[model samples]
Target: MTDRPLPNLDHWIADLAPALGLGDVDVPLRPLLDLTRDVAHGVARPAGPITTYLVGLAVAQGMSVDDAHSVVTRLVEERLE
Candidate 1:
């Protein structure tokens, strides 16, 4: 790949969550996992519902996987918006 700047790509991956941070793994997976947890936390509210799904939505802010899923489930069960 050519050394070039992209639209929404950042090099912080190697800075914050490097492969070594994950463990003695052959693949660079820490950055990926860290990013995931990041999205899961960054958008998390103490409570809420109907948050984004697709990993492609990796850019949206608000509601984590756990919190968002919980609120959504509750909304479905309790029949609340």
Candidate 2:
């Protein structure tokens, strides 16, 4: 099987969110992208999305997205250090 390059996720999300009833929702793509990079590099490739899912769960539980990203990022940085 040939490896296919992924599309620009941030662009895709911005384009698709409106159609998915999240038009007005502002996703903090920068922090999330940063978290994905950090987690994938510091931990494991699969951990990136898993960590993002946890961050989303935390947000749903009343934690700010920024705060969730900060907490996870800090943990990854500390563990990798």
Best by TM-score: 2
Identify the runs in model 1 with alpha carbons over 4 angstroms from their true place: 1-59
Model 2: ten consecutive residues of lowest lDDT: 1-10
lDDT per residue as tens, model 1, 1-81: 233554234444444345537333232233334434444455444221223334224323553455544544444445432
- In Å, residue 65's CA in model 1 sits off its true spot by 0.7
Please, what are the lDDT tens digits per residue for candidate 2 over residues 36-81?
A: 8889989999999999988988997999997998899789889878
Off by over 4 Å in 2: 1-11, 18-23
